[model samples]
Target: MTAEQKGARLANLWDKTLAAGMSEPERLIYRSNLLGSDKRITNYGGGNTSAKVMEKDPLSGQAVEVMWVKGSGGDVGTIKRDGFATLYMGKLNALKSIYRGVEFEDEMVDYLPHCTFNLNPRAASIDTPLHAYVPKKHVDHMHPDAIIAIAASKNSKELTQEIFGGEIGWLPWKRPGYELGLWLEKFCLENPGARGVVLESHGLFTWGDTAEESYLTTIEIINAAIGWFEKKITGPVFGGDKYRPLPADERRKVAGALMPVIRGMISAAEAKVGHFDDSDAVLEFVSSNTLEPLAALGTSCPDHFLRTKIRPLVVDFDPTNPDVAGTIAGLDKAVADYREGYKAYYERCRHDISPAMRDPNAVVYLVPGVGMITFAKDKATARISGEFYVNAINVMRGSSSVSTYMGLPEQEAFDIEYWLLEEAKLQRMPKPKSLAGKVALITGGAGGIGRATAERFLREGACVVLADIDAGALEAASADFSKRYGSDQVRSALINVTSEEAVADGFANSATEFGGLDILVSNAGLASSASITETTLALWDKNIDILAKGYFLVSREAFRIFETQKIGGNIVFVASKNGLAASPNAAAYCTGKAAEIHLARCLALEGAEKGIRVNTVNPDAVLRGSKIWTGEWKEQRAAAYKMSTDDLEEHYRSRSMLKLSVFPEDIAEGIYFFASEQSAKSTGNILNVDAGNAQAFTR
Candidate 1:
């Protein structure tokens, strides 16, 4: 295909969106998704797009020109019509009248919300006014890495003019807001023929009469910038023959050893909030010979300071033969020195006599050649910040080949870091989910109850590691989870909880994957129905190994990790109602479950001093979607009830006072209460999720 044809093909890719008959807002969604789909353009929630469209106001039944800009907090890649906030164009323009006389920068935020034409409470992105200021029908804004690489450099203005000539308007670094919007508007009107505008230390903006034209323009400019950089810049910045990367296993070992220490140091000790997720690429980059000088240069741009802070904290360590214990020993002093250095930097650059400092802890931790660990309020944020730094490294590499990498000066970084408008933009983020920063380990995770609980914890924002004995079932369940809740949020381990080695390896994997554990759901089990007279030795042993011994093994390992991390956690056992009230032909099953409940109580007592909570969920006959409720055992239970399998299911439902069927989801809900802070003080408690089973109710 020719160049034009290829460009058309790429633009058409975004056309597969919404329904056939698309509204203007839906088209905006399609375009935003197109922009977001390319990582080179923007990371999740990093860019904004807008379109000026005429829509009928529901209340007035009159045509209104509303500027639908990308709303705050939604990933541009998955944005829908609702992702764009609709604002009255006339009202937004009216703000210009008072812009000239404005005294404070924060006053823009106070009045910006009032410009909304739609009654929806969604806040517009900080760049909404910038998009609104443009007179074009469609405007595209994005933080393309290639574009930012040049824009954030020391000679950004000189480079821009050399590359794009007078076709692109250049603006000095200005904190984004109402004043910036006014400045951009005046610049655009004066340079009407300019294809786009480059916002130094920020991002790029392009516009056209149609979405295709605007999107294509953005692609063209970014491609041009990337092409120019490739010609001007040369070779790898970090990797060399002298600096060897650690073997995969060694890297993982180092990461596992040092993550907890880094997590503890950077974390808010009182709140117990932090994420120590690692990246192999990041580790390699940090460990390379070129890291020392490159890291000190600061972020690629001012916009990133919110995520990456001013610069990374480089902790000294010997990567060749890592001293895991020694590294751990030095973390306190290393972090202390880092905080002192940061305070000194702040004091030297403060605009006021007593400026309020942001978090003194480092967001990105570079442990020389060993590895790199990033900490944030949660997994997602830490991952995003890591991404920004990786991009920054790339930008620095390119800029280094050409000349020295000069990022936003320290004063500029501090201004953006503590800017009230920027702070307010973050404050507008939606409230976090219940288990936002917690990590959960769910055993028997591919099974009915296990899968349900894994999903439940994920929905509440916890990073979940699903452990299952069946590798196939675990793989399938993991793929399903990765699709629904993102791969970062869920992981799987092939573990037989009955095996001491398997249990140990599984918890170790969990700690390595997510730094540490917060909640342990011991739900992996099997149901056995055999009378004492007819019970087989094999069946009794298998049941005891899984239900009784398995819970003990997993709980024991969890307790060890909890004590080591010093973050008191929770353990929830999936005991059955049979343990509470004995039933016929279930002697082995009842004995095993009874042992589990007693074990939980024992641990609850011992763990009390450490603030560890242990609780049990006694679910009775959870037939729906239960693996144990199928095959020969299910048939035997049906036979014992003297009814068909369907009838047996109904019988169990009718046995409950509420006449509701028990399900894995119901059991999961009970586990959630104990796992979360909802039951902060309720340890050793039995939550019966049998739909009001009086016999199973805790006395």
Candidate 2:
């Protein structure tokens, strides 16, 4: 097909060259990855695919039919060979004898371990039976938007027939389990010629004799649905526009202004990361007259609402008037109402066996004329939740245009949301780290001390924004962090801390990126070793400008954000031991450091009522990886001590009472202690990380 033709349809990415040298299981992985590479076919971790392969049993040493399927909690797009669980087909089939009806179907999950082939440790997902019972050699199950659009319509069954005719069948909504497996098997038996079936309000399943055939069939079926929708949608979707979106820049400003407050309000229980989406679909939906009604009805696909929740809370705002302040003022009541309603929903739908009520905060929030906001425990999840909602928007657009859209039934949704098995999965998850869900911004982030601190925070589960005056270094550092941790857990901002406008803009960017700040590490600094007599006015201004004024500017911006959030914040100052103890010949440096230390004390005194904490970590010397040890400062300090630059580290180490060298990681540890809950109640305190420097003691 031509490129234009492919653009209008799902591209068949199957390559015979790529598939020629692969094992059956390997081909399944390849096909699954191809199918999942596009969000149009499947959302992140939302779909499963399988193939039946004959492999020698580890114990019996005999070839047996083994079902290889995407393991539980695995995403098909990134699935490796090990991601597929291997189950013996004979054992899976034998499970039908003990099938005690739909009510007891959940118990069927327990027996899956017995069906494990070759003692594969990967757990079989609940969808295993759905794939296992299908007699086809390969099956592809997906939550494609175009397919689900038909599946979620009020006339879904008829629409399915209209779209695919006899090529694909339709099955009414049945909670996926062993029972649903039987339904699929029955459908396949009844319509042996049919290639696929669309599960009502769930997704699509297609099968073929080979992995490539199944993958191609899945995409082709979705492409057909896409073509049908394109031809059928006659007018504007969502009843046309009610309000045009704010200008892009204005929208960002609004998001930057609003997210922190919302994040702070909802983050009382646990810290959250925020994701903002103003995509074309989101804008179209939010600006529509039907936005409120459509959003209230909730998303149709189960995968969509699993992350987005059943429905979104539409923010009260009129784009025509653009009253951001007014909106902020009214947000408290709106948020409170949303929580109460969510609680009532939990109370109304929860079964006695249901897990306890979870956080009542809405995951997805819609702003008319701006876009969508989603908050979650981490940035990736929040971002994915927004993406899922966008898929739901597309689903609603298609379903509503061709026919009436229908959300999943309340009881069915509740059952799935609070399913005991789902609860067990939640319980089985590892405990969150101490800094989990926290957002931090570190100035001088490209420098050794700053990068070390950020690495520590990222390791402990905090999302970090790396801000620096050096653009190249910032980019390099950001890239390194993204490689080590993940892009979702870190962002970078080019910031001249001494510039008020730059600092303000950087903080705003940080707020918009991660949904507000929780920890601010004011580590940006430089050093000079000039005597009081030799320190020129230019040198004095330079030191004071960056060290003193820069700190003030960043702190003011952080404080402004902290006030907006109403959540307690943390500020860790990477000051110098010279701040407390006199340093010979380093008059300007000592004064600047002294200013940073005093500023922390004053900020602590002023912010204690609001739960903000300010603390200082004083280091005598951190030469390794320290940017301050470069250029003239190192030579100046060395010459002042009557030594060469190479001997400065040794001289400082020997001069310390503990006779130990201090590295950037040591300063990072001190900063971590103050920034974390380890010092939750202590503020205006100084930590001496100078290897037993008696002169810099807090006393």
Best by lDDT: 2
Residue 612 in model 1: lDDT: 95
TM-score of each: 0.86, 0.98
Candidate 2 residue-wise lDDT, 448-469, digit = tens: 9999999999999999999998
lDDT of 1 by residue, 606-663 (tens): 9999989999999988887888887777988887778998798789888889998888
TM-score of 2: 0.98
Question: In candidate 1, which residue pairs get closer than 3 Å at backbone N, Cα or C atoms, i.e. clash?
Answer: none
Residues forming the 10-long window of minimal summed lDDT in candidate 1: 1-10
Clashing pairs for model 2 are: none
Cα lDDT computed for each candidate against the true fold? 0.79, 0.90
Error of 2 at 492 (Å): 0.6
Model 1, position 91, has a per-residue lDDT of: 88
